[model samples]
Target: MQLLTTYMVRSQQKFATIFLISRGFTFQTMDFQGKYHIHCLMQLDLKFSLSFNSFTGNVPADLGSLRNLTKVTFSYNQLQTRPDGLSFVTDLTNCTKLQLLDFGHNKFKGEIPASIANFTNTLHILLLGSNQITGNIPPEIENLNGLQLLTIYNNSISGEIPYGIGKLRNLMDLSLWGNRISGPIPSSLGNATQLLKVQLQENHLEGNIPLSLGQCRQLLLLALSDNNLNDTIPKEVIGLSSLCIIFDVARNFLTGPLPLEVGNMSKIVDVDLSNNRLTGEIPTTLSQCLMLQYLDMAGNLFEGGIPPSLRTLNGLQYLNLSRNRLSGQIPIYFKNFTMLEMLDLSFNSLEGEVPQEGIFIDTKRISIIGNKELCGGIKELGLPACKVHNTKKRRKLPKLKVSITVTVLFFIMLTCLIVVVYWRRKSATRPSTALPTEERFLKVSYAELRQATDEFSPSNLIGQGSHSSVYRGILDGNQLVAVKVLNLRQKGALKSFLAECEALRNIRHRNLVNIITVCSSIDFTGAEFKALIYDLMQNGSLEQWLHSSENQSDMPKLTLIQRLDIAIDVAFALEYLHHHCQTSIIHGDLKPSNVLLDHDMVAHVCDFGLARFLCGSTNLDASQCQASSSGLKGTIGYIAPEYGLGSTSSLLGDMYSFGILLLETFTGITPTDVMFKDKWTLHQFVKAALLEGTKILDPSLLSSEHLAGINGGQSGDVDKVRLEEGVAAVLRIGVLCSEELPVERMDMVNALSELCAVREKFLRHGM
Candidate 1:
């Protein structure tokens, strides 16, 4: 036997390697007794293979000496782990070129080692399923950036999925089902945009199925049944038009109406929404999924007659709509379902004469039991005959009531027309401003501004600045405008008014706020009046989104992608000012409050009250701004460090302001927060997080997903790794631009380019 083993090892080693790598469980030996001796083989990088063998004992720890080993499999064996856990798996670190390893379907018992992450980046597939392996999945597993698949199912492994796993950019499949894994499915999973299949069913995972998963436009199958998951399924998931395979989330605590967007998944084959606590009627829009088969929506609270549109799914098989509140006659279309193998509509309120043809001819293939109202299929089934109801006629509305309704609608339209005609004539009769120019689109008087803004009412006020207050107003032309009314009582109000006018007088860009018209006239009381008019932003300011004030709670949140676009918009505005414009204009204040969003959610950089044009190299014109002083021209917490020391407002100073703006926007933490006390600035706070490897991002950024075009599917960013890297780049730019020394800062041109690249990579492939 020893001679035969020696000859086989020498002559067939290379051929066996090819066969072992090509197949699984092909070397079973029922007559195998005691431990199959692995040490007796001529050891030249043993690419081992095994099957359902009785080979008992610890996996040899000497595989470290077989440095050239590439593929190894010992599935369905009796191999067990030593008392110290899978410590031998650590020895494979020496085999740096190793690619694939499988120990599944074995008797191996112990915790997976964190050191397994130390394996070569080429190691793409690792299977440890059907074992007694236990303990938490180590967070260090994120280091395996090249891993395409990781299957550790049917094990006793426990604990939360590490948040860092979102960094696996190449990961395509992750199967951790039938384990003891608990805690929330990481929203970061959405960042793995390449992910195709995820099997996490029959686990203890809880929390909402992240809406971010909608970003996986390439996702095919998702199985998440038998978990502690609860929450209304995100409509984005239903709108995943690419989810053409099975969509199973049964046996969960999910609630709320399934969104009508479910119709978007028209090509899905198998759908199982059974045993959930979902409410509301089955969406009739579900008729759009025509390729459906093996549909199981049993044990839900669905009501209403099944939509007749479902008759289109002619290939349906194995349908189970049992234990629901569904009512109405069973559709006759069931008799035509030639491919249907099983049909269970039990415990429902179905009432009809069941068809005698098709699957209904055999009681064994279908179950209509517990539905008391159902009757008459076949004599062998022994059901009572169904009864028909008498028909009734419908009533019509009174002619007198209909005539009165029409008269009221006519008067309402007539009144609106009269009001519109009066306003248009009034607008034509008297122009508002003391001086109206063709350059401006709209011209309005003090009274017109006052009237449009509800008599300068407090309710119409949208923003407040140091020298001005902005009020939302609608012109006679039905156009929305933001009226920046200057406070003559303030110290620098006059200079700020001139600075803003001069700064905006020549430059024009889409991202820059558009000036509609200015009003420089007196009121009825004969007091001074000066106001700047610009396009009214429908979505409000970035400040409201980041840190919403008390009165504005309904403001929609900004996702990572939206914020990135806003950053780029602001960058474009800044780039045009510093390079594209006739002269370099410094936006002295670049805080969140100064950035507004138009109706389309496109960002526009606003407020140029502190803007200054560079006359030459290092000098900011004296008349342009009173910015070179300890008091500073811009708001505190955003002013460049040099500004506090009485330094001139150069282009570099603007870079510093933009730097602080980026940090505040991404972190969602104000520069003036109490945490930045004791000489600890926001710059240092973010710099520390990056340098220390303790990554931090806005809580909203992490929780949100990339839901583009599906009911305003907007979240932070789509890909987590790209998100992490993109954020790191932005923060690094912030640090460099906000550096104490002006020369150390990143230039605006380069910064703009860097920002554009970040957007390109992060948003290249999301919904």
Candidate 2:
């Protein structure tokens, strides 16, 4: 490896003058000069590569002395800082052949030098992403006319994007997201007509989206969310017929009805126009986009019923119209969307009986919540009975006829009295009973569960974790349930077993898994144990969707908004357990595997076997003892460091676990994976990156399988951009939640609020 490095350096000196040896290559200063002199035979061809046996130190500044160098790739390995006073190799102007420069996925720091623009003659693709490069994007970058793909995302580039950016006429993809860039998006960018993809989200960019962008006829994807862009979406954008996906102008002050022309975009697929001030009814014309797959118009002012034509969209997989003013009955035509996997119509004013036929048969797929007038078909929502009222008036009987009937009855009563005495002796032989009152909960028998589970057949098991096995079963001959049989033997472990049962019984939240009943009895083997019965969550656990190797194409991969929603759901559930429950419940073990999802993909935190209830004087004593003892009580990677330091398990401990879960949700990697070794808490990982202005998690770490499932069968530029933005949003939320300082981390309310803000912004942008 060393000899190869030497030969390349010697060859570069004879051809290209400049060379950069990254990855800690070692060479004597005298030998380096000799090699450069030896290679000074022709036009210096700047070239360099790292060797495995290289010595570690700062990148040498002397390489800048070789002026005729271009094209450098020094990524990976453990190379440290570049030498002080050295920016771009000063000798590079002589070579003028530099085009592709990849310095990403490295530990480079300091401001991007102004001299970077010197490569304007030939530079095309500049990848400075995933680095510690700070400061504003240099105006000189506009000089690179040949530049096509410019990725400076995941940096600390501040200040407005230079208006001169329009000069890059050949630019195809520009990603400047995850920066501190502020101000309105430059309207001049519309001049870059060749641009196909543009990502400028997760920044401080503000003001109206430029209507001039309609000029970019070839544009396929555009994302400008998580900014302060304020203005109505331009109706003229519909002119971009080639546009397939758009998440423009989200989290902004935009307000207006959706342009009717949006329906004209026949090629468009996914649209996220949520969390905005947009008013007026959703245009029925949107139904014309037959290719539409995912539609999220939640947290908007869209009123009236959903468009009837939407039912014709058979390819639609996910639809969220939650937290809106939508009214009237849920359209019966929704049954036509058989391919739909998730439908959230919660917090609407819709009324009437929930549909019981077709897709509605899977109640979990439909979320008709916060609609006070809705009734029937579900016990979970406490729906009123669908009763028919008699509209016809009854005819009255004559009073004289009634008086004659009373006289006949008086004589009959005397005869009946004698008959009653004769029958009383016979009646005494019959069983006696008391009048029955209504019961709040049903008593399900253990034998019945065994029968429902087919005598605990392994084939019926849906999931098996460290604590229990969850099985899908039918109860009372009809109702479906999820039975979680505990691993503990009830005969010997009655105390701890009962404690868990009591904890689950007392805790109740819409987001927490509901415990329906408990079965505690001896099995055929005469071994007693307990099993918990809950409403069957057909969607399965979140871990399966995130990390399972099953055929998941049939399942809907969570969009950015959906992931945030689930994260917020889990956060709120934890908050309620810690603060609102009768006793503060510590979910000693909270991980993705324990978080179950219903058919709608709404998350429910399950598995409370290790839950610790803190209430009363006994709780205080236990707390003190736990605080003084060094013991860990959480998942391997998620447990807070303070816990090992003998700190009491407080709400903060749960927060730490939540942070890990958040990161896993974003990266789609398990905390226990080899990639996250070396005491690398997700919180610490994200925090360190943010402090250094670099991307915390590598996007490549996302499994190809998961990415394939998310983007499978999808083509066109818009679909790609939408998917990218969705991924970006998830990562942003993860970073925000995993901030090292608990105070810096957003609370559940604030996190949810911000999420809704992002949703509304997207809606206004007509994404």
True lDDT of residue 592, candidate 2: 89
Q: Candidate 1, which ten residues in sequence have the lowest lDDT sum?
A: 1-10
| lDDT tens per residue, model 2, 1-767 | 22223334342224222354334334334344322212222334456443222223445554544444456665443345556522643434444777777666555667777787777769887887766767888898899889999998887789889999998999999999899999889989999978888999889988888887887777778888778877688876753556677645556666888886675465677777778788888764465466778878888788988765565467888888999899988887777777889889999999888877656777678787798888876565568987777868666769998899999999899888988786676557643232211233457677878877767766467787565678766676345689988777333244445556756765678899977777778777787767888987766787877775533332345554566678878977987887776557777678888888886888999877666665342434565334323356667877766677766665656676787788787666677877666767565665565556554343542335434444343434564455456545555666665565556665555655665666665445333
Worst 10 residues of 2 by lDDT: 34-43
**Per-model lDDT:** 0.79, 0.68
Model 2, residue 680: C-alpha shift (Å): 79
lDDT per residue, candidate 1, 141-185, as tens digits?
A: 999977988999999989999998888988899999999999999
TM-scores of the candidates in the order shown = 0.48, 0.46
Off by over 4 Å in 2: 1-59, 62-70, 76-80, 83-86, 89-94, 246-248, 389-767
Relative to the unseen true structure, what is the C-alpha lDDT of residue 331 in candidate 1, on a scale of 0 to 100? 85
Error of 1 at 288 (Å): 2.4
